[model samples]
Each structure stands twice: as C-alpha cells, then as structure tokens.
Target: MNSRFTGRLHLPGEDGYEQARIGRVFNARRPGRRPAAVLEAVCEQDVVEGVRLAAERGWQVAVRSGGHSWAAWSVRDEALLIDLAGLHELSYDPETEIVTATPSVKGGDELNPYLGRFGRFFNGGHCPSVGIGGFLLQGGQGWNARGWGWAAENITAIDVVTADGELVRADADTNSDLFWAARGAGPGFFGIVTRFHLRTRPLPKHLAHTVHAYPLDLFDEVMTWLHGIHHTVSDLVEIVAVTQTPPGEREAVLLVTGVSMTDTPEQAAQALAPLHANPYADRALFRIEAQPTTLAEQLHNQRTANPEGHRYLVDNAWLTGTAQDVVPAMRKAFTDHPTPQTFTIWFSMAPLRELPDMAFSMQSEIYSATYVVYGDESKDAEYRAWLDEAMADLQPVTAGQYLGDSDFTNRQLRFMGDEQWARLRAIRAERDPKGLFAGYLTADEPPTNTNHWER
Candidate 1:
C-alpha cells in the first residue's frame, strides 16, 4: 500500500499524522474525529489508487480538497482521507474559453487570477482561500450570484474517480447521472472529482460600488426598506447588507453595500443607483456611491472579514416572507454581536432566476448567514448558544439553508427540493452501493433533509 502512493502517507500515531489530519482546515474549531490514514495525493492517478486502496482495506473514503469546510467534513473516523492539496493543476484553452482545474485549486486566489491574464473570469467563492471543489459542489454563491447565476451552472464537465475505483468523465453527454449529482451534492457526493472543466466569461472592464453605513439602532427601518426594494435593483449589482465592527471600530454598525459588475462608469452608476437611493441615506454615517474598485480589493475585504486561525461558528438560511415579518425576525442576527469580529450578512438573490435541472435546487430571494468569529476555546459553548438563539429567531421566515455555510452536526434544515433530494439518494445508492464513500457528517445515521422543527 505504501509503494502504491506517489505522495506522502501518514498513519495514526505517526509524527506528521496530526498535521496531515487538520493542518489545512480553515476553521480553528477542529473536529475530534480522525481518519485511519491520510494520503496526500500528488496527481490524479493517486486519487484513483487511494480509492482502490480504501476498498481493499475495508475503509470508507473521505476527501479533502482545500479543507475550508467549516465542519471539517473530510476527517471521518476510520476513513481513508485523500488530501488533494498537492494536485494543483490549472490550464486554459483559448478556443473553448474553458479552464480545467483540479479540486484543490483556490477559486479567488488561483483560478480567477489565472483567468484574469486571459481577460476572463469564473465566478468562484468570495473567500479567496476557499477551494473550488466544495464551493461548486454546494451550488457556489459567487460574486453577483443574483445576476450571473450560481457558479455550478458553469461546470462543463468533471473527471471523477467513482466508488468502484474507475476513472471516468461526466458531462451532459456522458455519465450524466454523476454530472447531475456532482453539482449540488457537496460533502455527500458519491465520487471523487479530480478535475473540473469550467466555462469562463469576459472580465468586466469597470467595477464600482455603493456603500451606506448607519447606526444599528435603525436596523428595522433600514432593513425593512431594503427587503422591499432589493428585488427591484438591477441584477448587475451584487447587493449585501451586513452588521459588523470595522477593524478599528469599537462597536458593530449596519452597512448596506452594492458592487456593480459593468463595463463603464455610467453603467455602474446606473446599476448601483437604486441602492444609493435609500430613504435613510441622508441619515447615514458615511456613504460612497459608484466609487471605482477592483476584484482584488473586493477579495481582500472578504479575506479580512473571514480571517484565518480563528474559531468560527457559521449558519445560514434561505428566507422568504413579507418585509414586516422577515425584518423583525432577523433583527437578533443582524443587530447582536457576542464578539468584535462576529458578523451577519443579508445577501440578496432577489428577482430569483430559475435553476436548470440539477441536484442543487433550493433557494429564495433572500439569503442570511451569521459568522461568529472568535479565538476563545473556552467560550465555544457560549458563542454556540448565542448563534442557536439567533438562528431560531428566523424560524418563521426561514425557508431552507445553503450547504456552503451549514453544519448538519449542529442543525439540519431543508437544503434541497424534495424531488432533487430523492434523486440524489437514489444515485448514491446505485453508484456507491457498498458505502465506499463517507457521506454527510451528521449526528443522525442518515440526514433527514427536513428542517429540525418540522421533523
């Protein structure tokens, strides 16, 4: 088994076993579960071999692309952890305008930067360090998702190692079931995706933004207005409202922001004008409208907001209701903060776009997520309690949850439409009938894709 691996392998109780286990995990709140062995795959063949080895050893296979999952889904007890950090392959074709990349490729940090050289872009994760694998699999809510659509919609094909240890390509024309399931399966995906072939778009020539900061005391009034008008804003603008203390600030404040993806200042100004028309704009603490910006600058801000080496407790919901009901229900999440770095975001996907037939089928006009950032291990219980209460406040208006920021070990919500969920389970049963893959990490034996309260 050792000779079959081209890359390093670490077994339990070894010198580097612990580091190989969770060294790459972004969340400081690590899991106690441990894999039987960690295989750092240096190439695609290694992934194939790893899966075969797992089957021979009677071990389930768990995979880690960038190790950014908040729940650390890769480190399953007694499973073979295939770490793809070393399989960093990226290339582009001019004729096709498509980029082929490995699962471990960082979306914002590597993929976009490489695409930018060719005057192109692929909507990746907001956090620069997030890997494209889990992000795309979970229905990537990338930049301007309200307009450009979910990033997973751009997947042209995938090279996967199936549970039977066979390497195959999946696309609309071939292995279609696997392709359909890959787009939205997230950690429960039945196969190991080695490479993603993604379609690219021309990079917008001009980028601009609008921002309005207000006191948190006016959360209800400001949020109510936003909820009513966000759907009317042009899809070219990515709208977000958040409450957080700035790097040097002493307290949290509400900030309504919009970034326009357009080719000219005029178009940017026109697209962002609706957000700037806030009735409370006159009372804002500060305002910046149609100011020029860059994608690098935007990604930098995201990196700052979600910094590394910190304990994080994150949760999100797809919200639907009248402004009167939704705004008041979200007050606790948007206004309260247990730590200085704690923040909550109200992301807009208003004027919802219809999704193509795929496994990733659950969303609404409004998306809200809370990130409780702190470094105190001792206060984990305290912060978790606060987050539970905050999310509970949204129960009435919460339609479902996004898999990207969700932790089923803590809470479960409907993440996929009923039909899609049923189809996904059937595919998993047929594809991985022997249970070669370690599926969703949850407290329950099999995840009941129903909201906890409803169940």
Candidate 2:
C-alpha cells in the first residue's frame, strides 16, 4: 500500500472490507465477487490519489457513491473500488434556488430535509435511497419527469476528477464535451464526479395520489387504457401500474397508481378526471381516495417497499408502441413470474420539453420494467432467464434498455442512439486515454481517437 494515499484502504478479510462491500444491491447471484482493494475516500484529493494509484498499479477502478447500481457494477472482482461514502455534504442557496451536493450524500432521503427548509426540492427518483451520483448522471427519471423533464436537465454544473487525477469543472461553457457526456453515460462514463450543482424548484403546493386495483382478467383493456390516458391528462399527473400478487391472494392484481401535482384537491381531481371515467371502473375492485401527501412521505413509502438486503434483477425498456400492442407479452411475463415478490412497473410519462445533447437519447411515452426479487440464491438462474426472455420478447416494442438498468455484459442495444454514442465515445477516449476507469469503455478494446488528451 502507498503511504501517499491519505484515506483508508481495505483488502479482503480486513476490518472494513465487509462494510466497504456492503451496498444497496440485493442481487445474490454475484455475491462472492470482490474488489482487489476498497479505497474509502474522505476528500477529492483522495479520489485523485486512488485514480493515480490504479494507473500506477495497472488496475482498473470501479467507482461507488450510493452503491445502488442495479447490476452491481460498482463492485467488480479484481478492480479497485473508489468508495465515496464519506463525502456526503449538502448545501442550498435560497436566493439562487440552487442546490449543491457531494456524490455520496445526495440521495433523496439525505437532501430532502435540507431542501424542505426552504420550500424547495429537486426532481429525484421514486426510491429515496438511490444515490444522486448514478441517478442524475444516468438521466434521472423522477416525480413528474414529464413536467420537469429529466433530472439531469436541472444540473447546471459538475466538479469532476478526470482520468489524469486532475480536478476540472464542467458545464455548458467550460469543459463542454465532458459536461454533456457526464449527463447520461452512467457507469459507462469516463470520469468521477465529486460534486453536482443543480437548480431546484419550489415544492409543489399540494401532492395527491390515487390507486385503482383491477383483476388480472382486465389486463388488456386496462393496460391499453392506461397507455392512452397520458395523452388526455395534464403533464402534472404521473401514472403507473404494477402487477403482482397481493398478500393472501392466489391471483395477480394490477395496481394502477396516479400522482397529481397541483395546488388544491379540486385541481388534482380535475387532472385525474380522465382516469375516473374509465368504463371498467365497475370492474376494478373499489378503492378511490385522493389525499394530500408530502414529498418525503412518498419517497419513504417507495423505499420501504424495496428495502435493502433483498436481491433485485431488473430489466427495462422504453416503449415503442401503444400498450395494446405489447400487453400480451407483458401479461405472460407477469402471470408466470417466479414469485409473488416479482413485479412489473409501467411509467407513463409526458413528452420531454426538448432533447438534451447527451448519451441518454432514447425516450418514449412509457418506460417499463420487471424487478425479480428473491432471497434464495438457488433460483438465480431461473430469475435471470425469465428476465432475459421477457426483455428479449419486448425488444421489438422497445427503443432500448435504460442505461441505469442495462447489463453491460449482455448489452444488445445502447440507451443512446448511434450518433450520440459515437460522440460520447470520442469524448471518453480524448479525456481518459489510458482507460483507468472501470466500465464498458474499459471492458472492451476502447475506441481509438486521433484527438488525444494533453497529458
């Protein structure tokens, strides 16, 4: 070990090795895979040291902040993990309505309180425990994403440590290419982001939610109706459907949830009027109550449903057609899921205001995925096969997998289009020529670039 490395470093069987390996990943399939050493960084200089050490030792580097990579990409065997758990600092400027956060401390649970004091909040994902580093970097899809757009759009600047162990600020005007590429590449990115500067919004005056539970027999009609309902509702209304077996029930049930962001209950009711008018309203098991709730409450509920320790194998895609076009395959997938814990989600979103020039190019009215959850390692192969088959069947009706959920090992298509990927690759090569970072770029022979970094 190098004395110049100022932060703590742990090897296998060491005191902190088990703790360093502890993360949000519940997937049990890759349990024994371990990092060569875990570098627990306390400061930006320590990150620079870790990168420099990896370069000197000819070892690849895996970076982790909140440690919620669906595929557990943060803990690769034989690689050095730069764990940023100690760097959780957050600050907000009320006058400017801008929030600044360190990589590890930017999860919704960590930042919501700070923002709440000023009646300001940023768009984060449904899960409160998701670290902002990976979430916002991969084009964060959050509460009312259609209304606010991808959470990445709210980011004004970032402080990043490049492959050369030099700190640089990236934004529209400075280090512009790195700024663009950083917005959506997820684990495929080339640099380690230390801090994020994001613009925040005034908290919604009122938040309301409603749920409709329908029988499985109505899957086709209900799904088709759910897909088209987005077009009729206000962008402030976000709707989702999850199909799973409720406790004590022998059959699967479809729970359609809706969130309306408005100033009053009356406005929320108006926004959700279309859903209330469903012809199958009679068929759905009756439960209709729209009540106000806080952002913290909503996020907390999402986190509780998906607690730590449960393994998750996720597969998702951007919809290419109406729900009517793809409901049969979805019905089959959900009906035969291995366990009651397994479920599918449908996020019917509004159109983006404008496409940002980043690697997260794919978009559709609906984003869909299945999360297979189980504690047993014995069924790992079965769940993996089920998810793979489901995703394969939906490929024709999907644009591509979301970058955050994408498994780089069996990558079929990318989250970005071909041109966006080419641009991202060029910038990655130019910035990190040595491939010190661990990800898809380093996993394969990296793309060649005539333009080289000024080392």
Candidate 3:
C-alpha cells in the first residue's frame, strides 16, 4: 500500500478500507496483521495487477470473496487483501449440465434455481449462503450426500489466480495437480480461486424434508438409535444433528432429513416411517415437508434465516463413531460457562467414497460427522474455548476432526498421515515456494505462525 503500484491500494487510513474489511461475523476477533493495502479486484485483470504488485513488493497475499472461510483467513494486517466481491458472475449451461460460478456467487442460491429449471443439481453444503470457491475447495458435504457424493467429487473445473496472479483454469484435463489438490485442500496452500465449473445431475421433484427434535435426557439413546439407522436408511436421506450447550444448559435437535430421489412422497415417508415409531415424549418436534421445489429452498431454510442482518461466528469439527457420551461431556462444558449465544453444531459424513484413486488429503475421509458451530459474537471466544476443551474431552470417546471444520492441530495433522501431510507441504513449497500466497489463506495469523499454534 505504501509502495507505488499500478493496482488500486486502499491503505489502512483510507475511508473504504475499514468497511470493506468487515467479515461475515462482526466483533468476531479478526486476527493476523492488518494489510496496509487492499486491492478491490473488480475483474481478472485487477487480480493480475494485485498479484503482480504483491509479488513485486514482496507482500503477503490474501483472497476474500464471501469471507466464509471459518478461520476468516481472507483478511490480514499490513499484507495485501485481494477482495473478490466484485467478481460475482455466474454462467450455467443446460446442455452441458455445468455451472461456472464466481467466488462471490453464493453457490447454492446462484446456481440451484438454474439447475432446478434444467432439472439438474450439484452437491453443495448444508447452508445456502456458502460460496463455490471456498465450499467446493474446502470439501462440500451436502444434504444430498446420501446418494451423490461429497461436494468436491462433483467439481468439473476451476479458474484460479495463481501465486504470480495469472488466471488459469484447472480441471481433470488441465493443471492436474492443482486441480486435484484444490478439491479439498482449502485456500491457504495455493492462490485465489475466481470461479468454478461444477458438474450437475438430474434433480427429482417432491423430495421429503424433515426435522425431528429429541430430549437432552434421551441424547445417548437418540445417538444409539442414529447409529443403527445410518446403516439402514435409503440413500435418499441427509441427516444432520444440531447439538448445543447454552451456558448452564443442554439442548439438541436430531434432524432427520430425507430427500426422495424418486416419485411418490407417500412412498418416501413409508420408507422412513420406521424412525417415527420411537416416541420421545414432547421432546419431539418434527417437520416432514414433501414439496416440489429446489435444493436451494431446502438449504436456505436450514442454513441462513435472515441474510440481510445477522452476525455469526462459525466453527467446525468432525465427529465419528457415536456421539452418545460426547453429548453429556459437551453438556458439562456448556454448564461450566453459560452464555446467551445461540451455539450450534453441524454433522456430516462422506458416504462410501467413490474416488479411490484420487489423492484427497487422507484426513478428509475419516470423519463420520462435520460439526459447524455458530453463535453470536458476544460469547465468541468463550464459546470457542469451551467447544475446544469439550471436543478434547470427547477425543477419547468420539471421532476426530473433519478437515472442513477442524483447526491446524498438530495431533490432528497426523490424521492426514506422514505421506499425505508431506505431499501437502511439498505442494505448498512447489507451488508457492516463497510463500507469497500464504497470507490470504491464513491472513488472519501472524507471520511464521502455524495453524492451531497453541495446540
């Protein structure tokens, strides 16, 4: 920013810089050194300028589109922030059954309707607010995952801004290494992603959407039942457990979502009717909606309530095995420090993977559940600390972290395995040897700081 460059530089003192740097969750502590200059990248050309300038000045690089990366790695102090909000453009081809969506194209909403109109759909996250560049690259776990596959498996192509800031397309046929790594490698290891072209499949009408709430007293029982049901359900089921501990209390929502890929909602209900038999005595709150709509609507109701005004600090982890006793342990942690924040937990798993030959980071597959914790900013740090301690307590009892949700824990890194971890490290070194592109991916951290530093 202090240096004279061809690109637009909004210094820390600039008027627009502060507002532009605002993250998805306000007051949600923004870490890392603040960037001295911010590049409002309006187009591919702007991205090139920003990359070029950053490299020339030897500045750290960071990329931001939706600021949805749980780590908020998009922003940094004294580094160069390359904002991608200006590149919100989407192109859908019905004939090819593909959607080329920008980093800013809230992937679910932007392309779902088009895909629906085309009678097609893509594997995406539970939340409709998630963007393509981050979600797909981070490894998407969708509600439809019961049948299709992980969100990453469906990606067809990507347009990325490499370390030097050149716009390149990566896919099965191009930039093969980068393409394979980006499937679930996340943002920090490489450069910025401008857009993505994803494969789509035919979508069916009259899908069943359901939500069932169980009592905390029956948490263990519910988890026990869930374990047995997972192995029995039809592939048309997308289930997520919403577990929360609000300072001094414990509550849970055992959501059972069934998406009928075939006709006859009545038949789908009959198929899933066995689950309804277990009565939870007033602790049960259920919604079995059989409607003719797109996955976008189904997710919108699940992820975001009010898009215009809402602050959310989201955290993640992967839970495997059964969550029976882990629930009680989590309840204990919540009791230790109670707050009014609405903390939440998101659970997901990759059903029998299809890409046996593909080298997805080994850690990506182990987790049977992905926990996405969201809450108000007031109790942000406290809740986060509690979640970690609680998760650690459950480590001996539950599954490990989900790459999509877990932090940079050294112990967790081992989950990636020595060979796999070496491959990722080698990839980072080979692609960005100078580590110039490291800033944006983890721009919220200090220089020389490793992820999950405390751990």
Candidate 4:
C-alpha cells in the first residue's frame, strides 16, 4: 500500500503473504514469526526505496535473495523482509569474461540457461535453486572447489545498497575494504547487495563420476584408505562419502562418490584412476557405478532427492587433521543417523589456489557435516539434539566452523579466526553506525567507533 515503493508489498494476513513468507530450504510455516511486511522488490530502485522506508520507520530489515539459509535468518520476527525473488535478471560480457546478475538469480534455473549458450560457466553452488547472493556471500563451495577456490573469490564486484539508502560499488580498486568484506561476510553484511559481477570460466568439456558403496562394517578401513590416497589424486577431482540407507536396505551404508572435471572422458578417467588403485579396494567395495554427465543432470538428481517441504537440521565442521583422525566421529555420525533419510557428508577439499585474506577462513583439509532431514514436527527436537551431539563429538578434530552451515547465534571466532573477526566487527561498526542490520548472522556486537574510517 506504500506508493513510494516501486514493488508490491505484502503485510501479515495479506492475500499473498503466506506464499511470500517461505524461505528456500526452511519452511517458514512452523513456529512462524510473521515478519512486519514482505517487500518483493522489482528492481534496484525498489530495494533502495524499501530500505529508506524501513530506516525512516525504525524497523529492522532482513534481506532475502536466495531464502536458503539452513537457519532461515532472512525472515525474522517483526522485521521487514526485502524479498529479491522478483528481481531475477542476468547478463554476460564475452570479452570481459564477466557475468552480472540481480541478487535473486539462481544457479540452475536462471544461470545455466544462458551460460550453456555462451559455452561459459561460473563456479556456483551444487544446488540449482540456490540464489547467487547468499551462496557467494557465504563463501560458495562449488562443484570443483579444489581446482577453483571459494565462489566469493571469483566475484569481481558488487553493487551494494548501504544503510544510508545509497547505492555504491565495491571492488578491488575502489572501496577495497567493502569488497573484501562482502566476498565472505555471510549474513553479517551491513548492506543489501543488489548485483554481483563475477568472473567466468570456460565450461569443462566433460564431467564424469565414479561411485563406490561399502557397508558400515568397512567404514574405518575405507575412510583410512581414501584419506591416505589424497595426495595422489588430482585437483580436478572431488571425493565425498556419505552414510544413508539405500533402496530396499534396512542398515545404513557408506557410499563414496568421486567426480572429475576434465576435457575428455579419458582424462576424467585418468584423473580418477587413483581411486580404483587402492590395494585394499576389493575387500571393502560393495558396488561400483560410473557415468559421464552434465552439471544440469547432476543438479536435477540432487533436487529430486532433497526436495523442498522437508524439515532440515544442518551443521558442519572443518577437519584440521586427516580423515583417519576423525574416523570414530565420522562413523558415529553416519551409522547413528536419526532417520533413514538423514545423511552425513565428508568433503575432501584440497585447495589449489593460495588462500585469500577474507572473513571465510575455515579452510581446513576436509569439511564434514550432518544433514538431518525429516517431515514429522514431533521429531524435530530429537533430530536437532542428535546433530548437536554429533558435532560435539567432532569438535576435537575440528579446526573451525563454516558460517553458512553454522548456528549464527552460537558462531565463534573459530569460524573466521580471531583476527578476521576483529576486523569484521570494526568495519561493521563504521559502516552501520546505528547497528541497523545487526544479528543477521553472528550476534557479535560491533565496535563503538561512530567515526567513519577512511580507506
């Protein structure tokens, strides 16, 4: 009903309010807080105006670009939700090797459509429906993270709407600090990002994978062998292990899936050859499957398996030591899953690029997580507690936490390390002097420096 806003706004009990209130992964229906209003911004101007309105009325504003936060931080109680779903748009410059898009743009639905045409692709999240905004901001762990780096490092520039309702550009040569902060700021960002300019890469000619399954009895042996062979594997490959019950199975099984990015089938096979060379492979193997596929095909299966509607309890930790060091915890995480649908993932990430100085500093050798998925509300508390206990057991081997999968309220310096945390707080205080966008991520209080710091 606000004429000044360039987009449609829905208040509580409004006709479209329920539909607009949904977050990507978290169904906002249960224990719903009911935001003060949801503003579906149609363009950058709409976002600019909406921010000004929220500030004028002294209302807390929560920016929602992807709506996929496992914790559902975007739709908070009594806050004004700036929904960017209506702002979906994408553009690419061949000569510049850069792709620019509105915050609401998704990797599978919006990006791949155009990227496939140009024979170019950006390293984005594995999920098709994930929005580019939060994915990149939270240090995107894309398909081949080892070969490329965090998706945030590929971001060349960002157009941010600051707390003062002014649009500004943050990049390397200009507003450097803001650029550095925005790349890995997660949900703690002090401004609303309207657009992202990212550097693109040539799409690999072939994407293929080989999978192996082993019974829980072989978990330790298989895990030790896999970790021991890490150095022999190529950066073009990724090996992930999960524990879940297969179709027609009553017991949980440990499945190892390995993917490779290469120019040809032969190259892909060669890159993954080390996996099959394990001397003890035959003793632990239960099944094997291999295939060559496109990114779209892979994402399709992922979406089908983990569809929207299910309740999820997600948490992750970065392993400081090798997989062998965390074998006991990993075994327990998978074997004792709360439900048949629940899964625990171990990501073998070997960085090929020099780590950048950013807020996303949890760059350990391997990343481990438990994804507890179910539909029954009655079992929510039970599943959450299980995940908490699993993570607690893993704490000894963990170097830090991943902000994207972490509980914002409980996040500590371990996620970004103490130095980065201090710097983030200082910048947050200077930029958001009024603490306008506080508690969107970690609840750490910003510094008291109201004085604007110069670059």
In candidate 3, stretches whose alpha carbon ends up further than 4 angstroms from where it belongs are 1-8, 23-32, 244-261, 277-297, 303-314, 322-343, 346-351, 356-359, 362-378, 407-417, 439-455
Model 4 clash pairs are: 24-67
lDDT for residue 229 in candidate 3, whole number 0-100: 57
- Summarize candidate 3's per-residue lDDT along 1-455 as a digit string, tens digits: 43444345687777877766764422244554577578877777788778888888888887777666655666665568888777778777877878888777775666676567777777666666666666776666665564667677877878887886788998888887778778766654487787788888777655665556555556666655665555455666655555443235444444544455555677667655645655552466545444444555666565533233343433344444444544454454323324333434433343554553233544321233323234455765665666566556545544334455544421232223345446666777888888887532321343222224234
Clashes of each: 0, 2, 18, 1
TM-score of each: 0.99, 0.93, 0.82, 0.93
Per residue, candidate 2 scores C-alpha lDDT tens digits across 1-455 of: 74766679988988878777754444554556688888988889899888888888888888888887777778877888899988778899878889999987755787777888898878887888788898888898888887778889888999999888898999999999989988888887888999999999887788988778898788888887777666667888888888877767777788887788888889988887777777788888855657677777778767655667777788787776766577765765655777777888888765546777876777777788888888887787888888888877776677666776666554445477778888987897898887778766324544321111211
Model 4 stretches with alpha carbons more than 4 Å out: 23-31, 284-290, 322-324, 351-353, 409-413, 441-455
Best by lDDT: 1
* lDDT scores in order: 0.95, 0.78, 0.59, 0.77
Candidate 4 least-lDDT 10 residues? 446-455
lDDT of 1 by residue, 173-265 (tens): 999999999999999999999999999999999999998999999899999999989999999999999999999989799999999999999
Worst 10 residues of 3 by lDDT: 442-451
Off by over 4 Å in 2: 22-31, 247-250, 441-455
All-Cα superposition RMSD per candidate: 0.6, 4.4, 4.6, 4.3
Candidate 1 worst ten-residue window by lDDT: 440-449
Give the per-residue lDDT of model 4 (tens digit) for 1-455. 56877789989997988777773435422436677888989989988988888888787788888887877778777778899988888999999989998877887777867887898888777778888888888799887787778889888999998889889998988877788888777888888999999888888889988778787888888788877776568888877878887656788888887788788988988888887776656865564534797787879866755668888788888886766568876666878888887888888785436668877666777888787878888887787788878877787787777767766543343667667778888898898888677445444643221111211
